[model samples]
Target: MTAISRTGAGRRGVATLICGALAAGGLAAAGAAALAPGAAYASSHREAPLISGTPQYDNTDVYAFVSPDKPDSTTIIANWIPFEEPAGGPNFFQFAEDAQYDLHIDNNGDAKDDLIFRYTFNTHTKNKKTFLYNTGVVESLDDPDLNITQTYDLELIKLKNKRVEHETKLADDVPVAPSNVGKASMPYYSKLRDQAIYKLPNDAKTFAGQADDPFFLDLRVFDLLYGGDLSEVGNDTLKGYNVNSIALQVPTDLIAESKHQPIVGIWSTTQRRNAQGYYEQVSRLGNPLVNEVVNPIKDKDKFNASEPKDDAQFLKNVTNPELPKLIEAIYKIKAPAEPRNDLVDVFLKGVKGLNQPPYVTPSEELRLNTSIKPSMHPKRLGVLDGDNAGFPNGRRLTDDVIDASLQVVEGELVGSKNDLGDAVDKNDKSFEKYFPYVALPTEGSRGKTAKSSADTKSALGDGLTGATSENTPLIAASAGAGAAGILLIGGGLMWWRRMRRNY
Candidate 1:
């Protein structure tokens, strides 16, 4: 969600005494709510029945690592609302006012965050008195196309309860007033978004904004196919969507102990209540929080009901997914493995985009051996590639995750090779060199009249072919008559089964 939409919600009130007690006891207040003892599990991505409705508060993806560009710092990137539309205006997205957005760093492992960076946004909408459809036009503002403006403020906080604290810091903890760029500057929203950066100490920097989403997965096809094998859809379908992002670049010394091996786990959250009576509720959390696939339940409504502060609770839910058992029972899949340990591992540490048989088993969280220093230009090998830069460490936009995951699941890492063949890297489109790196085509350039569906399909077809046709089956199979039929049948069965189940 955009920061501008979270205007005027009051700050959060102090937690209830019970919550305070839990916090004091070192227990996650959100996890107090227990789950059923022996239930099937699933990934947190679209697991929650409540968050499926409210995409903004949904925590999609989280990333953390020592910045390769700056050896002295760690960069944290969180994305929310996958596959966002560049022109989803009229009523665009925004974060929840009552939500508390946070970036958690686990300086000391043990699966807990040591240092936390908290952020909150306050929004204000102006020119409410105007009645025109386009408020910034000369006729509406009685001036050139610069009259309509929207503004917002931000706050970043640091915490060290049971963890180490730094003696010195670079950036001040204060609310920043971001500019209100209307239509005239619409073309420069990318630039305006970059201008919102808040530099940190030791040349650290941070920013939050809406940008063309960097993730590339054929979500529509996946949804249509339901929980079927996504291998057949190809990656090009994920191209060109948008998302909201929060990026922070910090010095490495602060993130790691001695720079020899700094292990940090990155996660994002949004809170609805503050220490004070102020209750700013978050409507969204994490990068690509809930836009990738279909939610069989009331997806949109559920998404609106969630908040990042509820993460511990979300974890609990995934640890014991009630829906998977239901799916197993309905499908009669041997009643599923007892206790549903599958989901626990995936939520904690499974590699992204690599789902083997029994996709819901729990595994260890992605583990990055920082001891293995990354090459300046490491081959973009994914998790299965014996490279540590992909999942379990931090996910990058260009990682060929699908291939890596498939190989690993097929036991390739264990010295067995089973090819799912090859596919394109949809996110390979070059990113910006600096802050707010995602760049998407402008809305005007992407409108229906500007680029029809047929045109897009043709363009995608041509692009996927060319010199790399031998590597991608989507291109090689484009003209195969029976391939489309087989895909349709497989996709249809999966879709029907998924739709038949009740969460």
Candidate 2:
């Protein structure tokens, strides 16, 4: 199901909060366990019921931001196949050829997609008779030894003025970068990844391949979400993880309808032609985690399948968020109250002047203001730290969403008064400083689960400090808003903000 049209509803309301950057959603909340692998605490892993069982097409996370280095273009990256173990050989992870993965832009913002960027992958096995992914050291994406390879085609379709126009071959037969097997197999991994970057006819640049997963969070946050000792919990759980990413870098005006109002809302979704011969949205994400922690189980699947227009049913959940209440109940932390128009305006609508499109609807989509110039000293904490070009504006590769999410949801403002964080401060690897900005995928041979942090025992003194939950008083602060990292809201959506969380 694609191509729905709507006129303009309007842009977000004025700065009713501290800053106009935060949208909504985080990597995953620190609490609430789920019945499925990706269902835990509302990160974009296996966010929905049906897609949790199918990781290949489960939309993990979508990041949209104006290129920090190249501010003239907008970078949109959509990831899939999460919690990837680098060494899963024989058959390494690949995009599902049968599924259609898409990144949509709601330029006019009536909760309908005005511009759509779709990617369909084709996995080709050169020597199907072979058991190995590559018979020998894979020289290139086109190397004959590569027994199995994948390539994709990209299309930019649009619904404008009630007219549907299709651009069939924005990029065609584009070779996807191969999995980083090992140094022996992929000696020049950088070259191999760069080779896959295809410049589109629309003057956009595209790259589809395996890359390091940029998301960072303390996974144990689900279990009271503590990790003072690195050994027990502070380790980066996604250290060796990899993902199939479809990325595009295009001029702001190419996607957004207006030149003056460069604000545009974006989201990514995956769908497959089902048994009934109907295309069904299996995974949908904009801001982040709205499904995992925000919605009741009964409505989670429905939420995934439905459109942003239907978000009103779930509006109550955000207006009166249950996660903050749950956190306050268990952790005895004080959070903001309901009718959280603050959250509604930031999460559903864009923060007024920053990312909120001139004409928009209350929908779940990553909104970016192309006008916000990139920051050289980019803060991983994003808007909270006052880097307007960071996440919640439109997530950059280095944005520390976990911390930002925790601070905002806890009712803290973007100030130094309260320090709420998961302790896993950044990504496993430093992201590349250029286009296709995510770091290369972890080598298959080197992949493994994260271990405890090295500083674990030293700081906490063998669980003594870690056990001071009751002794440490929650810091108290006003609900005055602060700057935010841009993210949005949805089942798989991730909206970002900076805040104080006092105990």
Candidate 3:
């Protein structure tokens, strides 16, 4: 979100050389001039028209990074069902039972998935007689009062030459962390979330549940970059929203080809069962905003359905991106030259020598170098600011993707150097520091009452003290119930405290 003076055409002269280097298979140096588009963050909340209508099956975002706590492992997180209102009730957000949420890894960088982790969910309602999500104050995931619940199956499918080479069920009937209904219903939401973190073989961990939408940006770009006058910038549009998230952590050696070739490409897809009972790939995401910002309206949905191997069909969109031209028209800034091979390196192929595979098949997937250790102090700007441990290597929860994307699109690579951003620098809430790094979902009771336990307890205490001796027993009982409700909400405080310690 910062601005800087342009260095002029002195830098622009290198574009041709970059293209030449790419053609001559010497792009390692040329591609190093700028950060990859993988760091250019775009929130795909209802990005395409068709996918917009089906939020449950829509892929919102995908994040990959080396596990900070356990540096030997890699973590991949994917989200769905964006912009969920905390108060939206009766039928709270849930994963699509008929959909297969999959995370794909192209270890050999052939633009084909070598490994796929597929998650399928099943919804359960304990009481058909009640309209409530919980029949009573829910104490635990398996509590009978937690009427509506869900469990999921995790399958690890290995592939070769686009054919299923082998498939193994990694987890069966794992409890999904339920939605945070309210303080009264889910006082121990964090405990429930911890219970949902199921351990997999080989020191891997998996979690599926509602979470604070980790994406933070001013989505007002649809309104001509904030009413076309830059008046509407700086707002975190997704402030209070939530999303259903799935997170997986595994050993780096498991997905990488070898320590000699440690890079891996990652992406996610949603396959929904159609009318004919066939599962169709409806949504796909790798880099933050490829489909949302790069592809045009006509190709957005198609990009979602297309595979990385077939990415040549959409090369023109990247070479002649429309965003720069829009900036040129609106703000009188110059667009980068066409046939942007630099963009190809940023978007399709990984940045040379950084995260790119040796024989990468020019595709759109988040290519991560697993050998890069986690940063001791991460910079929000990621690789642009020399934090190789962050985005462009692989996105972390704290990476400032929107700002990076804006600067890159405005010609940071082709020498039109300037700091362009939406002014939204960070998420509304701090991300968790441990595995399954997303923040907890906003409760349905959020903003309805005092969040602090001390406040709630004091208010209930005052009520009890004001009661007459004749009615003291009744008031004390009511106060006891109120205090119990306060304890339930206090559990959230305990979770935050724990997070702070781990963080």
Candidate 4:
């Protein structure tokens, strides 16, 4: 798991401005967004105390935004299975068949999911004789030579007062994209990945497969926290790591069903069936990095198990977080004062005019406005850069959330000045403009720092091959989240592949 650290503030300042064009004094097509806590580039990776044990069900990050290509549709992407080594094995990472992956929508700020999309997977091995992911993947998704395969089913359900009132399984059996082994086996990996995109009856689209972990961050927070050199902090720890991604593109009308409430709250969770046949919720994420950075050791599991409605209980920590104090103590930088209503306005209760609902109890959920128009030149600084189309409004793959959040963490509120950063600016790979906007996963066949067909070489000749070396050991969970010391992300000083993110 990649550990999150403080983001460096940037050239511009971000403010709590809510800009959405409401229609007829009702929920209309307008640009809007909610704020989430920003961690270092790692975002959420095995953060919870209990859920850390279940890596398959562990969610890394969640993203929701208005589609830049298809403006009418909203794009939602959730990542799982973090810090995946490209050459891990004959049996690489696959979604657990027993685990239920969910993307939830709360159109109103009631802190409850009104619409829920659930998915489950099943893996099949065509040939058990040899331990190979693919015997000879020479062709399409259903190639006969494709020895190992995985398929999934998706269901869209509606909840009224948290009771299941409606549920519908999507028409087709979703095919899970095979792991990018190598150019020798899966020669044309992009074509194979594109085939995984499935269109639904409602004109919605969904995809479940491997993708380049879109998160980028400097993992040097460990050293920086101890007053290390600022230039050294520029190294990105998450570069070249791959993650499992589930993306959905649905109409704005579907998410914003209530005409009165255009603003919707979004979050993701994973559940697993216990021996008793009862499903237990193991992991949950809304606002990024809260469980990993804010909660105490004893309360991490409790925070994961609790719902957004009960988030009021966690307010004290948010108002007076320990991270900034640590930064102040070590680096001598004065952070914001406690009883941080600014944070409450930015994260929990969405900005009054911007993303927050009319009546809401402060909860940590990524808030998005369905009506917001897409920006042609989307800025990495998001709302701070006046690119209302970015993070803190609705998260986009290109948004520099780490830097944005770092500015806020260090008291760079509205009408303030600042400049902080990790220097690693973009994702390892370029993002697509259309459905399933996340880029392709770095091939699993590549050794640590070893280049693959999917990887473009950097100026230093080092590809984004983060911590894939055989010598790299499995990092401990406690080293990753909550009150237990800051987590360790990928090893080595990372070298990023500079790419144009604007699509």
Candidate 5:
């Protein structure tokens, strides 16, 4: 919701790179550039037009890494849809039965996944009788002995040559239980989620489940862009929140060679009933939902529809899209001095190698090469300074990726010739050490006649009391102009392009 605007030219440049090839004539290229359009940052939680309506199968984000808790193993997590209220349920969220939930790994960087873990869910509703809520006071049952029960099953499918190489049923050895509905159901949701965890053929660990959501961002700030104050919106808004989560843990050895060269790229997808009974898909490939939406690209729909398993074909589409030329045509500025074959290298190969002078890494892809082991964890990895918990490693909740992305475009971390912007700290909040990491509170509990254990826990985690305030400015003064210009230009170009396409 942050209304950062890119100028017409800047947006045109972005649009050209993303839309499609430049026309044969120089004028045509210019015409395409002029048609560049605006692109918006699709919110990982509630951005997609289709998925937002269907939370059960909508995948909000996907994360993969070697477990910090157990460095020897890898963990893959996919969050289905977003904004799930823990207590909001006559029927709580569950995975789709017809959908395929998968975890992909690319040991060989052809931009394709070498290993895959697919899962499906089945729910059995019994007794045919239904009640919305259980008030602890049980009414007379027509059939006292008849009770409702539900359960599901999971599977791990390995693929080679686009065909199933092997299929392993996780439920074969483990019992798959349905989520806990209430007392009658025993709330065994956690246990059912745990059943999905299994050991791979090589003793590698794997898991999938619905855990609380772990992403934090301020949508209110975006709403304020039309005309509102973001300064008053503290980081507390995202505190004590939760979302549905799917997690997996595996061994790095199972994913990459000991040599540790970069060997993985990840993506998540959601398929729903299309106009035809066939499924329509929505995907987040390589670094969550950024590239397909925020970063420049022409085939936004195609990007969303494609799967990570088909990366070889799509990688080429991402690297050499006709959009760039279209942007150049619109902007009237010369493109990067040299032919950017490195676009493929940086966008597809990975960012580690792209950190050189003159050239800067294009979009941030969370790259995890099994080989590089830092002696210490970085404070902030992606965009948050001192935030080592972001992309190219593993993304964390507190990472202010918008700021990080601006920094990347400006080439701040790698020191490109391009003029970069200063950093911004929109939300000056700190986090708690719990399942969902979020900022602590700044006030003390009031109007409380008596404090219970739950109150005390909430107080401690709320950060309202005994919490220090940090006055970190979200954006440096110097960065405002260039960043705004880039946003406006880029956005304008995207808008133009879309209009042209429609015609």
Candidate 6:
């Protein structure tokens, strides 16, 4: 039987909650997990203070959905390094070589992960003598002119009760798509991205590269909640930004439980090597705004380091949320009553019958029922609009989580129907219809240079001249100034070497 048919009671149960408190005139709170791996915005991108300073290892968003073109397979995409400016180059963006990026899945109702896909990257530089991200117009992934490149290894791990039962290296030395350096460097950026998509065993596929920041929403909500008058609305704050992404697609049966039970919970985390060299989870994400909007400041850092099995310790934040109270005080809207089991049902435990697994353990993760097919024209509001294949059921790239979350958090399910939103809707760029559906990264030379091939080649040739071409003259002049000049040159060379290493 299909998931929708089997979970009829669960859907009805949710409806009952929606209808029961129609007269309350209270705010419905938005709380749930997951977003398209390509999507951006919300607190998931640098949501916590400590993680914010370390963008490379910070998880921005996570997306899991039944592949639209290949419904028999499931696709999971996770992004890191939020708000990547295409023009921000020289060193550009690359996955952290010292960190482990992981996608965790809970096939059973228990909070423990049953399967994990771990990705680790390694960076290689061809011409370190030249401080250029690329020595010339990089035509391909393996081009020597592409001064810096990255490759990753993908490992599939099966676990039982939080212990690894088996481990298999699914892929090794897979090339990562280079950053969109611009028309001069990567005029065929899409072609480069296509080359990065790797076909794996069991008809699976994987991709790691730079893509457009798919998350769309006004980030100005921090300014006194839209200037306390809803004036801050309709702006797509992350429009031109880019993000580093890792995407994978596998057969539905691969990650699903038995045919009798098909729901799976998904989340992603980044474990960075601390000073002691032991990997420690520094960032985590599942739901769109859980840590950003739900967890308080004191718990934000703690939430990143915690596991879902221990989420009960933070239950009070969800049961008695502070966002609604803040909205109530500012907008004169009535806040929902305390001890909100509705939130626990939606955010922690999967909705009964719909996506909930047998004997659920009430943990935070994006839940998806493999039995549910993809929607051709999915609604942005997701389940609220009866689109079962979208978010809260595995986030899609097009789901308008910000608006949907706004209404849900303001009491759409518990009677207080509202249309509250930040006014932003869809992404500034359209998404691709094929595998690794994220939009192409914004170009570094967007609307600036339209250089000809000769012009580009000439520029690269000029850039190839090492630091001696420019700085040697200065050092020579300083040497003529005697002892003071020697000290200055020593300090200058040390600073130059450090800068080169950083890039």
Best by lDDT: 6
Candidate 3 stretches with Cα past 4 Å from truth are 1-43, 447-503
Predicted candidate 1 versus true structure: per-residue lDDT over 21-47, tens digit per residue? 211111110111111111111113444
**Tens-digit lDDT track for model 5 on 58-176?**
66666655455565666666776466554555665556766666666555544444566665556444333333322221122211211322233446666665667887765433222
Give per-residue CA lDDT, model 2, range 1-503, as digits (tens): 11111121221222312111121111133222111112111346765677788898877777888887778889999898988888888778999877889888877767777888889988887655446676555667787656688888888887765467666558778999988887656667788898998887657799999999887765654443332112344467778889889899998888877787788877888888888887778778776545766677777777777777666766565666566665555455555655555454455566676777656667666778887888878777676566777766777778877656565555543221334555566787888888899998888764332222222223223223223443223211111121122221332232222222221
Compose the digit string of candidate 6's lDDT tens values, residues 224-323.
Answer: 6654544335568898999999999999899998788999998899999989989998888877776776677898888888887887777676666777
TM for candidate 1 is 0.58
lDDT of each: 0.42, 0.66, 0.75, 0.67, 0.41, 0.76
Residue runs of model 6 more than 4 Å from their true location after superposition? 1-43, 447-455, 458-503
lDDT score, residue 501, model 6? Answer: 100
lDDT of 4: 0.67
Per-residue CA lDDT of model 4 for 1-503, tens digit only, reads 01112233435242211100000010100000122322111145766667778788888888899888888888899999888877776888899989899999988787778999999899988766556676554357897556677888999999988999989988446888878876666778888888999989778999998888888765545443524344344455778888889999988888986646767888898888999998887777765555666666776777666677666666565566666666555455665666666666777667666777877756778888777688998888777666766777768899877666665655557434555545556887799878898888888664333243223222212112232432223222322353333222221112122223332
Q: Pick the candidate with the highest TM-score.
A: 6
Model 1 ranges with Cα > 4 A deviation:
1-47, 131-185, 220-232, 235-237, 273-374, 414-416, 421-424, 440-503
* Residue 354 lDDT (model 2): 70
- Give candidate 5's total backbone clashes: 70
Tens-digit lDDT string for candidate 3 (1-503): 22122332342243443322211111111121222322222246887899899999988889999999999999999999989998899899999999999999999988899999999999998667556786555666887667789999999999999999999999999999988988866777889999999999988999999999998866666665333455435678899999999999999998999999999999899999999999999888877765665667898788778887887776666666666666556555666676666666755667676887888787778889999899999877787767777776789999877666555655677776645555666899998999899999999884343344444434434333242454346557976899999998899899999999998
Candidate 3's error at 137, in angstroms? 1.3
Candidate achieving higher TM-score, 2 or 6:
6
The candidate, 4 or 6, that scores higher on TM-score is: 6
Say which prediction, candidate 2 or candidate 4, comes out ahead on lDDT.
Answer: 4
Per-prediction TM-score to the true structure, in the order listed: 0.58, 0.78, 0.81, 0.80, 0.57, 0.85
